[model samples]
Target chain A: MSQAIDLDLLPEPTTNVAEYSVSEISGALKRTVEETFGHVRVRGEISGYRGPHSSGHAYFALKDDKARIDAVVWRTSFAKLAFRPEEGLEVVATGRLTTFPGSSKYQIVIEDLKPAGAGALMALLNERRVRLEAEGLFAAERKKPLPFLPQVIGIVTSPTGAVIRDICHRIADRFPLRLLVWPVRVQGDTCPAEVAAAIKGFNALEPGGAIPRPDLIIVARGGGSLEDLWGFNDEAVVRAAAGSLIPLISAVGHETDWTLIDHAADRRAPTPTGAAEMAVPVRAELHAALASLHARHGQSVTRRIDAERRHVTSLARALPSVDMLLALPRRRVDEAETGLGRALRLSLSENRRRFGEAASPLSPNALDGLVRDKRADLRHAEGVLGHALSRGLAAKRQRFDRASLSLQPRAMSARSDAHRQRLVDLGRRLPRAQRFGLERLRTGLDAQWRVALSLNPDNVLSRGYAILRRPGAGPDGQPITSASELPMGAEFVVQLADGLRGAVSTGTENAGAARTKRARRAAAHEATTPAKQGLLFE
Target chain B: MSDLNEPVLPPDDSDVKRMSFEEALAELERIVSQLERGDVPLDRSIRIYERGEKLKSHCDRLLTAAEDKVEKIKLNRAGKPTGTEPLDSA
Candidate 1:
């Protein structure tokens, strides 16, 4: 606060000054910086870092414990940076110290910047990781599960690097997946942004767009120093990895080197090949599993069908036999036969009764009348014959008397006796022939009576075959050979060997029912008629 | 630039690209399982099995179709993709 001691040591100002314009002063200052500090190297921690401006210039500040100075890098020089400048990164920047008159600030126009040392870069990385972790960028919950099978895998790495080759080779060895490489500078000023942009670009893809969306992503790079691998530790790259909708795997540097992206990624692999292995399963293993599943499914279905078949077979075995199901119909058939026999016998008997009634009027009385007529004719014929004979004898006697004078009397008498004998022989033979013809007519009448008796239904019934007759006046009433011909609840009669029995037709003669009925009838018949036992089972 | 040394490139066929290896494998597995279950009708089973065989061969073909093609993504000054080139000399 004291202003007393240094007055004599201060220099005096001259009155004849040049009065230069702001541009002139700024120009002189720019030339002085370009010449004096051209290609100077400065080591300091990066601070207030900013990207290359649209005009191809970067604005930033370089700071030490005592002071901080504004710095910049032209786009051309920035392109040459081996590592990206970040806040709190101790780096050695080589470029001229220049001044921006507009802001009235002095700065180093950086031609190149590199991390001061591996330890410094690690410190910077740890600090960045701490800040990112606080923002939940590396939270376990933010990580996504890798797809079991990724249709495509997007890789963000240098195309010429061994990292990409390792990844591709490993993936080919395992299960080949469609690969899309986003060529990027793995370790340079542009590395972080390029990596981040690649991640975002893959995410921006539509699922079925011209450029297929990657199901998984791998950010990979080969082994390098902490500074060389620092791009993966960058905030932008970490955020991109954390924000990716597609699952990501970080494989940077050797197995011992850990990057911030590793924490942010869904999975972290020790090397690029390892990341490839994590991306897809073994092809043969999956194929084998599918085959086994197929086999198991087949076995399961076959067992089910087989068990069902066995159940059906058991059920079939428990069912009733076909013959047992036909017994009732067979019994109905027997009953119908019996009824027909009885009905026929009744018809025949009725016919016979009607015949007797009609024949009674034409009996022996009529025959006696015929006999009287025939006797009268015979008597008349005998009278006529006697008259004719007497006339003829008188004529013959007259003729004989006339002829007697010319003949022998003894000869004439002999001839008249011979004629009387011939007449007697003829009368005897005619009566005998009529008697023989009468005996023959009686024998024929007896034979016809025997035939009529034998043809009677009663005779057939006595032979053990019954006739069944339905009481109606239609074709159905004639006789039923099949149970289907009988209507439900129809009345019928069965003529047995000795008598007739009335019965009703029960119309339940389906195939199975008829079979059971027939079987029962056969069994019963076998019991009653041993001679038919052999035919029952047949 | 390395692609200049490469031989003739294969003709562009979008069908192969449209069918993903993963999808083909999944379909093959599904078909095999369906056939194994045997719940499918005989005709249907045969049809699906035929489809499964096709899918299996598709997967195999996909794996063996080409060698790993490592390509460099060509970019403009602004880092937008322009095209691609083979990463190797051949």
Candidate 2:
């Protein structure tokens, strides 16, 4: 109240003095506020944190228990912040205090901002982790299997630290690989950006580029506190590791230390050395395995060859001998020849013996004996006829004398003369009859002699028919009618019209014998070529 | 499957060197199994065995020839590698 009364008592300014507009005064205020507090660091809980304006400026408010002040962070500075500013989160904002003339308001233009403490940072980290995890960035299925043997290994770490040395040494002990170190700050404000950039840079390398692309990546750092290791847990680094095309192994801090990178990477090693060990296998064990395989190969091949050889030997033993099969037909030929010879001899002798029996009854001596018996019969008949005639005449004379005495003497003498004449005629006729009988007998004898001459053996032989006989036979020996009756191993004679032929009986000469021999030869040939016979039979 | 009458050719070294350690090892194991099957011809078996030996030796050489090389990547103001320097292990 006193200040207001005093202002009222003081003299008003003269009209000659220059007057100022509201815009001018507001502009002057803005300049004074900006110049007075050029740069200030404010600690407050974020509230009403809103917009990135169209001019790339963020409008927000920083408040505490006593008061609240409006703030702005330019997009350029906001883009550089490692973490986002959210409502209800305490943060330390570093920037200039400036006044906006349009609203007649004063605000801090933030240049840099960070979480106020480790707890605040952790809260931000957990928020980010939850968001990213919800996005499936940390899904187990998203992980890739690390190559059993990587040709080139890209590393994201501080080149000046012992982490790289341990990794290199451990890899050398196991299996060596080409290491492409991408040096970066492992902690601090710049650490996340540098590490993320390194990972992205490795991923962008062309496979056939001048610098060989890495088959796998290892992001590693030595042990540190939560603040020191916060970079690995940063969203930029975790997203970069998760999005990498190559398989990644995260080896940050000690064995128990955990980072968001460990969750996002394809594999997590307890330490830097552990990552190296996982990359390759031991060399000596591989050599031993190869040797064992070589021995097994040799043994299997030898066993297979031996089995085949044994099979061939057994097959050879199952075949038959050649000589035994040939003798079956030879014996059959000899029996056939002997049968044929016996049949021929029986036919020839049967013909000769029949001829001899037929000729004996028709011999010329038989005809002569028949003629002599006829002549003797004729002489005895003549004597008996003469005696009967004389007796008849004497009885007739006595009867005639008695009858003549009673008859005339002239008739009696005439009868006697006639009787004497009749007797003479009878004697002449008897002689003629005997001559005719002898003529008939002589004609019959001549016909029998002609038949006997026609049936002679010598005459039959002269007509080109030959008789085959065994020669030099004794008187008791009849003509051989069968081969069985003929002597064995004897030479036989064949009589023809010209001369006699001597022939030895060759028992093996016959068609049957020849055929049997041919069959035997064929059987022998077949036995010798068992393979051919097997094909034929099959 | 290998043909019994196919001509056997010697193993080529440049070809073997181009293979990765895993590829080489896998090929070596394949050769051994093929030999164990005993269906391959003698000449082919011998040739494959020789190739297996070369692969084994190549793997051995890879392990023996390796030396740990530590290097520091040097970056410019824009964080691009300008060159490299030997890294101190200590």
Candidate 3:
């Protein structure tokens, strides 16, 4: 009976039991678990990373390139994080192991996590870039040129927000361009369609004949995360910008951020104000450029003018007048005058020779002498006539003297008787001798008259000087008779004389019978006496 | 010919001959792209920087003119624009 008491005292080979309460037991188990795996490192991709909220708790996942794990942290621990925890983040967590008894669940109470050094995010980005480049989406040739000075610019942004105002203010401040504001939601469900419509609206204004069809377009918004800037990344907005007729300049967010709109746009600016600055060139710079160009053009034009002037001067020098005038052969004025003088002298000599030849036959003195000789001959003829008349008178006187002597002897005997008879006869015819002598003188005068008449032109005509008679007055006014008188209708008669042809007209005497009578009478009278045919004598 | 060895081609600068603002900006972008691509040699990269310097100066001048305009607007806030204002003098 003592031996049985000794075995009981030896604790009967008892089970290992803990000497603590239920709460203490659980606490101790947790402490052991934590101590065994104190500050462990986990390698997994983050699936859900709820960032630190107002509750100061963060729940997130650590994900691989494909799979992920859940993660959580309290406020105190999360506050110490250098980087924000997020879903799809591959990270390594440093935490103590903990367990819950209610569901018997196990987890890590995360104290810290860091990027796993290499992330799938960077790989994904690179892959996308490569893909876009392969498709020539990012080709430099695809890029367009922007306007140097755009007057009207269209902007796509939220209607009532600081983004639109910020853009407008900056653009207005820089350059006072015509701004056509196209308001659209930058975020939320309607953002994609609204952004696309705004870009399309700007294009529609062009086709619809709107004033100042937006020279440049700027799609812009403030900085945000990938989700916030997703509107710009929409395929519609990107396509709209790419297809737009006008140049587009995108200014989506901060410099680090990029979007699809930026890639497809004609140009990209980091900020809204930066985009506005590119739209216009400065007035001052433009003025300088214009001045330089003007100077250059002026110089060129001046050079051309100078060249033309020189060419004209040379042409003037080459004219024909200069060469032709200087090249003529020489001649002397005095020599030419001498030659003319010699020609005049020869002409005078030739004229003198011709005059001597023509006048040699008749000397001036001989011509005067011949005229004097003819006058002397005429005087001789007149003197001979005078002598002959005187001789006749002398012969008659001698006859009278002889007859008187004879008569005187006879009268002496019968003187007494005849004296008485002669006295009586003397009384009857006083100076009968004087009377008879006067009678003889008269007879002598009559005979001389007959001789003179025979010597006259009329008597000469009777002696036979042929006379040409026309029927009428001719150019010489000669007489003409017969039907042939006035052959061409002229009128006159012709009288013949010794040395003269005298013309008489019977044309105006009378009519036809009277004219014939006058003509017959004239012919009869002309034929009456062959020796003397004068009417005065008749 | 010896004097022309440097090949001093005339600078293109005038209202008609000068490059447009957009052209200058596009060249600037090419320079940036060349630098980012890293495919260029170091010497080429330095050349690109030199080219970029000129473009930057041009951009700065443009910006300066804009700043002056801003200042002018602030000064002219009190009066209506009159026909007598000389635009050339401005």
Candidate 4:
């Protein structure tokens, strides 16, 4: 209790302790923070980054798991950032910390921003891809197909790097071509700018200028880590690649690594060498293909000519020779002459047989029986002919159908079919013509048979006419049938109604006279039928 | 198909020389197909085939005569491209 009373009685005269204003406190704290952390790297995920402010400053917070610190990048510093800071991206913020007097909050004004790790860098890359893709930068329709053969190839890569050399060597090995190498810093802060400018520069060149404009562009780089190859992901580089007038092939890294430029490029080669391979075809293979094509063209023409020649030769073969045409008609005339002699003998025999039948029977019943027999034979013949014609037609139709279905040449088959049709038509007409000829000959032979019966010697002898026989009158004569057969003064025997009588015939050369009475009947018969004899030698 | 007697004008040797590799090869292919199809008359076939021969030789020359080495872009002191220079010594 006494100590408390003593303390209460103590003087309140502490005057040396300095008091400061809020502004002064804030300024001192800012100064102290700057001095302590003037140059520091804070590795943390970026928070609340929404791009640059209208005033051209970036304000964001860098946060680790447990703590967060405000970060700001000035306009100039933002332009130089190794990569654009993205929200929730783990980055190493390098800057000094200064207090904002107005907010009474201390923040780090970031000088340079870099992705802290590969994982965070990939995340940032993916986010940027989503944004750029949404703008249709990587649309497939925007891509241009590379020319089959490019006369001039423009390459965007560092001249000093092995990537350019590898590309050149590969291109030379496959097919040599004009190459325009736009030497650029492949990686670093200035890399993206230089590469983009190189692409745009090539695009601006006039076509067929002193330097021929490139038909193709290759933006290539050797394989490297994400950070080393980060320049290819720059917006300028990707946009330039997407906007190239000529087709562009991006070979930024190994097969597994893909940069934003790869997406934007017309083609994405796995390596610089691969890009060169894609640019041109092998010269040797092309030469071989062209040579084969030329040879094939020659062979095809020869084949066509051969085919036409064969066609002409076959057509010539189809025409009948002149000898064949003449021989056919000449043979038919020979056949007709030989057939005429046989027809005369047959007609004589037929007339005798008919005469015998007529003398034996004139009954109506016999005539009816003969007619029935003839009709039955005709029916049988007609049935057989009908069957034969139908069968032949069926077979011919079948043959024609098969020929049509076969793969034989159409024109040749069609011509042969016409010939076959003509033969068939001629064959059909021949039998009908033969039947008409037979009917006419039968009517003529019946008339000749009646006249021959009238000239029979036995019938004439019974009519009080003696048949005269004379030596040397006929080659083998039993009787002299006409006065023209007797010589000038030959003795002849004449058979009268009683018996044989001796006679003498006298005929002068100037007179066509018959000395015997037998000559009268023979002469009258000749006068009545010069028509029957005419059939023999007409 | 056109008439067999109709004349087909063929590209001259000079035209083949001016044609690019793709153009020459395409024309050569077309000629081969025309002959192969037997659509062209003998006179026309021979003429176009001669043209194809010229095209083939021209493409071969294009392949053989390509610029062999790469050329580097030459920049001025201000870092602006002035022209180009051979990158390799040859």
Candidate 5:
């Protein structure tokens, strides 16, 4: 099995080869890749796409049936990518080829990429539809019931597009309500992310914040190419649609263009205008419906009342008449009254019979006999009492005569003589006592008179002190001890040991003070005037 | 946060706006049913009928009196909606 090949065919191994580090070789290869295939467009089916990495840089492999090439989309490039790379999607990726030194692998750094063709895009969408369907995102049960009439409707679409204007016009023509538009790029590299964000943002709105949360959401776009509408097929957009708390209506393209969001949303409208129509009922129609409802309500109520009234009337007719119902009771009452009168008359007659039977035994003759018997007994008692009384009276008279005989007049005369002598002795002693008392009282009066005389005003006058007074003021004038009390030219009195002497007030006897003194005396004599009023108010 | 699973949050009453169309409709229906039953007394029937009339009027008013408010969400640089602006921005 071992066949020896020619020695010359095997080149000799060189001992002194160019010395180069692994980095240098790798760098050379990297440079060669960058320069030679700086820009290339390759068609392949995307494989191993699990979305972008955490760094936002997408790492995947593009492979045809024959071969596969590693692809790298940097975060910036991925952001600018017109369409997201889907797993199993056929795309024509355009980018520069470079080597990853770390992994020792060559890769294309994609800048711009798109689906290879409309057919390929459709295939990708179908594939996605199947995968998402398997994941239950497209399940009918996941759909939310659209609000009957949303107070606030949220729209996820481009702000400047005709699609938005159409939606607004349609909504205005119909029931005009609060519509909160979450502006997004309907078609571009950022379409999916922006649309998804818009959906999530509307969901994130606080229910009662300054901005009200939307009760319904419509992700709408106008008619465009399949490529233009591809963003709606994005997994992010579909997932967001499926996860919306508010019921969502997808209106991404024309009726012919269907996107994955259509399957995921609660409802699908043919166009943006259709979405608006779906969101709210026509105002005129709603008014008409409400009016009809109101009429129906009124009719039902009136009918119920009429029916109830009829029922009441029938029930009243079935009831017995008041007079008929009371007839038996009234008759019974009258019977009872008549029976009561008869019973009273019968009882009266019965009472009379019993009284007559009892009275027969107690006739007047029998009563007289009883009275005669009682009188005879009383007469016998009286005779006996009189006889005993007379005997007792005779005995009492004899005893009295004996008692009188026993009494002595001499003893009584003797007692009266003693009493007279006692009266005479008492009378004599009382006069003697009265005379002694009179003498004692006279001596006490003499001592009191001596003390009173010693304290008399005459005694003070004899000691060289004379009393000064206002002349003619009183029998005993008010005293004036100081000369200041004298008014100029006014007469005053001075009392000596003998009597009060009148004098006239002349000059030099407190000349200035005298005028004020007289005025003060007069003022004091006058009745006091009412008190001077203090400040009554500020 | 799909409405199919999560409970619908109650409407905010702090806002002075009248009842929403759905609420008014539902209430009107309920009152109609109540009034249709003859078990209700006359006084109570009249009162509830009046209430039903009010609810019906509220629904009707909601349909006609509402002004169109089409405000597009204004987004920040990060593509996050910060608030809203009128749709027809000249």
Candidate 6:
């Protein structure tokens, strides 16, 4: 019966490759998950911890004091992580077990982690902070000043959130600084990797020459729980911040809030507002500075002007005019003028003397000739009368003697008188000689004297006619001898017969010829009119 | 009270620019201090007092001008500028 059963049984232990529909496979997986990974508390040290990446998925391990377990965290669960898990950290993970069929790997899918021992995890973090702070890692000296004018500020936070909006509004209100948003998780398990990546990306862009490098970076977010700001506290973020070439301002939370990033950054502002203030200078303050400088400059200029004015006033005092100072030079000039006038008078006298001496011979004979000619004519008349008289004289010698005596006295009296007597004698002898002849001769002489006197320029001059005697003469009253005589001007005398009444220059006369001609004319006038009594007899 | 109504002369550029803001203020204060001390020669003391008065006025004018500008800027944000006009001018 055993042989027959073995022959018939099992139908060759059917190796049908375990038939399964897609639905059945999933059902089995669900069943396995429900059965094996039912709510359990697993003790382990976390290792190869990947808290959160882009998809908000966390992958890590839960390790015991000796061993670790693989685990995964959905973004929803990771969003609530109180503390960050790291490799080699002992923890008790509470979660439902799950299996991944693709890799046939079992993971804890941890919902929660707590310190394996009794002490709180936060205490360890605080101690770590204290240790870092003790090393001067959080010192104020470790910080750098924010840029005055940030051209491009790198913002690292979630794209769709009030934090970014608040930061943006604050920055915009304060100053129109350029913003470069790099959306990354500010909290949750994925944040550390994303935050580190954002920092590195900005750094790499500079090395790659993708664009002009940002002047400064603003690692900013609104206020949050410590865990919410955990990514900034991450070791990766801290190292990246320390290593980055760009200066960074950590604007993590409200004024009261502080984070690990605050310590690691080049500068840590208490709030986003404080960060903005640190970044930009106030416009009002700058304007005030410029105004003050202008005022100071104006004041300095005024002082210099005042000093110059004082100098000018002092100089004015030094240069004042005084009567005593003016007296000496004025006296000297007056004395010189007196000397010049004396010299002019002396020179004029000498010129007159020289002119009179040179022109004496050219006289017109109106004075001496009248006397001498009349005397000679008288003598001839007397001689002829005497001859006639001698013949008759014998008879009346006495009478003749008496006549001679009377005549002798009369002969010396005047030739004109004697001529008139002879004429009377002739008239007696001829008895036909008329008084007309004698009268005519006398009238002729008187007429000649009148003509000569009229022709004398001095006659009219004596009657108050001013003779404008230019220094020279042509036939006209002008001083020019010829056209060529118009050379340097000559001095002229307008003589009034009395004295030199006026003087001028014929700017057109040759000075030498003009002077000589003037002297000759003046001399000719003097020669024609001898002085009345004395020179006429002499 | 007499000082309040008294006229003041402006400082020259050289005097103003020689000192920092704080130093200038301190010097102005020193001038006031000297005036308060009143231990100088009459002529010298008068000059010092005059200078102090001028400095006080200058400082006051400077602060007043600054305040005026600040007020104007704030007012400009709302509308137009208005205030007590400067003396002896349109």
Listed in order, each prediction's TM-score against the native is: 0.51, 0.49, 0.35, 0.54, 0.54, 0.42
Q: Which ranges in model 2 have alpha carbons more than 4 Å from their true place?
A: A1-43, A47-61, A64-67, A70-88, A91-119, A294-538, B1-18, B37-51, B54-58, B61-67
Task: List lDDT for all candidates, in order.
Answer: 0.77, 0.80, 0.64, 0.84, 0.83, 0.63
Top lDDT prediction, candidate number: 4
lDDT of 3 at A361: 79
Ranking by lDDT: 4, 5, 2, 1, 3, 6
DockQ category of candidate 4: acceptable
Q: What lDDT tens digits, residue by residue, belong to model 2 across residues A270-366? A: 9999999887676566667656765765676667667667888899778655665556677787788879988999999999999999888997999
Whichever of 2 and 4 has more DockQ, that candidate is 4
Over A1-538, each residue of candidate 5 has an lDDT whose tens digit, in order, gives 9998999999888798877789998898899889999999999999999988898899999999899999989998887777888888899999999888877988888998989988998776778899999999988988888988888998888888698889888988887788888777888778888888889999999999877899999999988888888888889999999999989999988998889999999999998888888888888887777777788898988898888789999999999999999999999999999899889999999999999998888778999999999999999999999999999999999999988864789878889999999999999899899999999999999888888877777676775678878878743888887766776777888888877778887777556568879978877875476555433121
Scoring model 6 with DockQ, what do you get?
A: 0.06
> Against the true two-chain complex, what DockQ does each candidate achieve?
0.11, 0.25, 0.04, 0.45, 0.42, 0.06
Q: What is the C-alpha lDDT profile of model 6 across A444-496, one tens digit per residue? A: 99878877766776666665566544554522355333445333554555666
Off by over 4 Å in 1: A1-43, A53-61, A67-77, A92-120, A206-210, A327-332, A343-538, B1-72, B83-90
DockQ of 4: 0.45
- Name every residue pair that clashes in candidate 4: none
Docking class of 2: acceptable
Number of the top DockQ candidate: 4
Stronger candidate by DockQ (3 vs 6): 6
Candidate 5 chain B lDDT trough over 10 residues, lowest sum: B7-16
Cand. 4: chain B TM-score: 0.76
Q: Tens digits of per-residue lDDT for model 4 on A382-436?
A: 9889998998998899888887766668867899999999999999999999999
- TM-score, candidate 5, is 0.54
State in Å the error of residue A493, model 5: 99
Superposed model 3: Cα runs more than 4 Å off = A1-135, A159-175, A306-538, B1-90
Report the C-alpha lDDT of model 3 over A1-538, residue by residue, as the tens digit. Answer: 4444555556544768657877777777777877897778888777655546679887765656675445678888776654445456556788877776554456777887665664444553446556655777656687778877665677777656676667667766655545666656687535766778777767766333523357788888888866567567665777787777788889898889898788878899888778777776545565565444334434434454566579899999888885576554324555677699889999999999999999897889999999999999999999999999999999999999998897776667776786788778778776787899999999999999987875665555665555555534433544333544533334334555533343444344246568788879988997885864446454
Q: Candidate 5 regions off by >4 Å?
A: A1-41, A45-81, A86-88, A93-112, A304-538, B1-20, B23-48
